[model samples]
Target: MSLLISFSHLISRTFLLDFLYLFSVQIAQQVKLNKEFFSLDPATGLDGKIYGLPLYGGTDALFYNPKLFEEAGLDPNKPPKTWAELQEYAKKLTKPEKGQYGMGIYGKTVHAVRIMHYMSNAGANGDILRLNRKKNNSWDILVNSPASLKAWQYLRKFVDDKSIPPNTVELTYPDLISLFAQGKVAMLTTGPWGIATIKAANPNIEFRVALHPTPDGKPPKLRTAPLITVISKRSKNPNEAYTFLKYLTIQIGAEMAGKGYGVLTQTAANTPQVKNNPMMKVFADQQKYAYFSAQELLLAEWLKCKDQAWGPAWEGMLMGSVSPKEAVNQAAKRIKEILGDKGNLIYPVK
Candidate 1:
């Protein structure tokens, strides 16, 4: 009886292992996935395996009110193409007496990720953290690099010019979305999720989407956060779990995109339902340039560093309590401490 019990346990464990292996292989062979949405397991490093499927993903782009542009004496059809132009447009759209600001800068809780979007676009190599191809594929922290500093300095211009809301430091993305919906802010950089939120808030607001502006009018690299689905290794029926996953990711994902609930990550899943919506179209177009940030790739280390180090440092810089260089250095120090020999630090030589 004891031998039979032990054998039964062994057989169950073996079945679980086999199911997991087959599930991974089936996903690779059967599913059509966006390669950019494919993520590496930070806990295990890159094992060259597919463990999850992204149902939908979100990416940031410039959202401007066309009416505000017209009111500011700027061409409604021609949005800013570069950071300099964005600054200029913000100055024009800002109307202090009317309680209106040209731009919305997210500075409150969880603002580190949003700010990273700007840093990513301004990165010299199009990323804040890059894998060094020549250095055993080690990650390089470039948050304190010159391009990043320049991005910070550019943001400071809004504070100095009073183009951002007076309560900017007290507001997060949702707050900014509310402000934008109320027509208190002229422009914002946010994800597609903002569309439904804005429309639900105010159906009368006229807005358009554009690709995020870059430092030199080059192609922008924005941060993407993908909503992925994975099956548990302990599932009783792996095949049934996979079937459900397909249903949710493909059929339901497309329905969500069509209804303006969210954006789908699967290209083939993008039927007329996705393409028909003007706002959804822009987001779909922006996916080609969207990527996951290093902080996102390594969630454990990032959670430790973001609020404790990066958030405070970033807020300090935005509020003029610290310089851009000081903020970057401060955050980088804590990040390195947390990361600790995980990868090589590649700060530009002074």
Candidate 2:
């Protein structure tokens, strides 16, 4: 019953621990982390050294009501592949007169980050943010770019057209899940965790998870959030802790995958339970294109901007206080102020 290991969320915060710098180097000299999608995640390792292991990850996917689709005259088996098709599907499925909206979007508040990132999958590269590798790897705010504007404009269309539920303005993930489960909304963006929650809430509902629709009819490059487990720098037994972590991530991880948890290693994902599970298969397939947020590595300062600046900007757009362009531009201004001279601008400053 000794405390050999401690599990912590948000491995990014490990950057704040002074002793972890030394601990990371020690771990790198001894072992390697589980390496599935490691290349795609810029946040891997602490300051160019191995530190923690990604235990689980979450990527947003479209969950739709097959009954609603059939009712709307759309094929229940085939989900929308493009943004245009999604819109048409929403329009056909919407029954505002009957108190049902076709889609559930978190228009305003901090959840806007998820919605905006989902839009990025539809071709909003470098919009909200992107790494400027050419400029010493500085973070660039791309809110005012054409790609960003197009994405937000589409969201505005959904808001203006009433395709999204009336309660969507400040909707969090739980709210959207509840709405979808209660049959108030037909479509939503959620991760694999949502499937079980939806079933628990409404077992009779027929729903399926699909890749989020893109604007160009191609597979979208969506953002992924991973649950990483880091070893404590002040651990009493660092070696034992590492051994336990390695086992958890590589061995037990497979077992967890079958139960619908995101695993860090490919071998874990290849387990019969995971491979056979339908919903997990969709998430596994999408892992190839998943990328982590830069904010994951930047931690506190970036998160501050997300909450204080970006959230309000998106809220303004959703509430009709500003146009899409104005909302995004305002966000960019606030972010630039937060980063100040620290970040290099890839997009031209307006």
Candidate 3:
């Protein structure tokens, strides 16, 4: 019986039922895992049944170039702890004449995820579309909430101040990574995976990682995406598959982390491979305040909303064609239309 390991993003309700089997309760109890990963399981509809084991995935954090910080006369050891400080530091780091920008802003089509990080830092609890677990897991369309408005407006300041690239709206994640590696951008908000990418891009670059700055300089609630491993229902040897899964996740989890993959378990994070690495350490520490976004509940709807609704609105605001409030309102209206009768919608008060 061959065990199938899938890393695709097509894990849906039908995919879960037709392809995967729930892990036995005894198998679950044998190993300790982070509780947050459980919420990311696609088998959420199955009450109290474990279907997947989270292996590794990225978590958001602030990555900065220490050389740029020193050149700007800012302390290389002290990264921004609040939004205000970030802005101040960005201004100092901006050297427009040299073709350098202070920060890299994601204004591309899939920018919603990065925008949600700002919303989370501004006290939206790390989600613009929140799942009200108290209301039977109903959806709350908080895209136009006060916190969200503040977040959008804050991003606009970067554009207005000319602290980001001129082609920000066209820049994708990889573009930003390339810019950061080339030392064209002083600061970036990315994940642990960036450590390896940056090094591979420029082996001599000097960089450091820090927690995402919040409004009040407190610890922030941010987003994470964990890769999970599930058993194929068609497998003839479930026990054999379980053994391999355990060995992959438990025994060699730290080795994976050392290779710049994500650290899924505390034991792996505590290992010298992760703990001693300055960049990876910051991301591992950030996991304590990280969460999987509520949008995961209805991923298809959320992706559609990004394509047709919020994505456009967000870009329009950054492009100066729309006000932040107007953009948020427009996004909320369209999202409500897209998600009609799917989950409970909480519109902003007029």
Each model's lDDT comes to 0.69, 0.70, 0.73
Clashing pairs in 3: none
Q: After superposition, how far is residue 156 of candidate 3 from its true place, in Å?
A: 1.6
CA-only RMSD, every prediction: 7.5, 3.4, 3.3
Q: Lowest-scoring 10 consecutive residues by lDDT in candidate 2? A: 1-10
Q: Which stretches of candidate 1 lie over 4 Å from their true place?
A: 1-26, 29-45, 125-139, 266-269, 348-350
Candidate 2 lDDT score relative to the true structure: 0.70
Candidate 1: residue 237 lDDT (0-100):
73
Tens digits of lDDT, candidate 3, 1-350 = 33334333443343433344342333455454445332343333233345566676667788999899998899989999999999989988989999899989877847676778889777643345765556664567888888888898998899988999988888888889999999999999877778888888899888899988989899877776666566655567877877887777755766877777776667677889888888778777777777665365334466677778888888888788989899988888887887776555465634
Between prediction 1 and prediction 3, which has the larger TM-score?
A: 3
Worst 10 residues of 1 by lDDT: 1-10
| Per-residue accuracy of model 1 over 1-350 as CA lDDT, tens digit each | 00001111222242533443433433544554545232322322233355555566667778999999988899988999899999999999999999999999978875565667778777574334565546654557777877777788888999999999988888977788889999999999877778888998899888998878887887776766566566655567767777787777667777776665445455423678667767777777766666645344333355556667778878888789998888877766766676667545577422
Clashes of each: 0, 1, 0
* TM-score to native of every candidate shown: 0.82, 0.86, 0.86
Per-residue lDDT for 341 in model 3? 62
Q: How would you order the candidates by lDDT, starting with the best? A: 3, 2, 1
Check candidate 2 and list the clashing pairs. Answer: 127-142
Residue 94 alpha-carbon offset, candidate 2, angstroms: 0.5
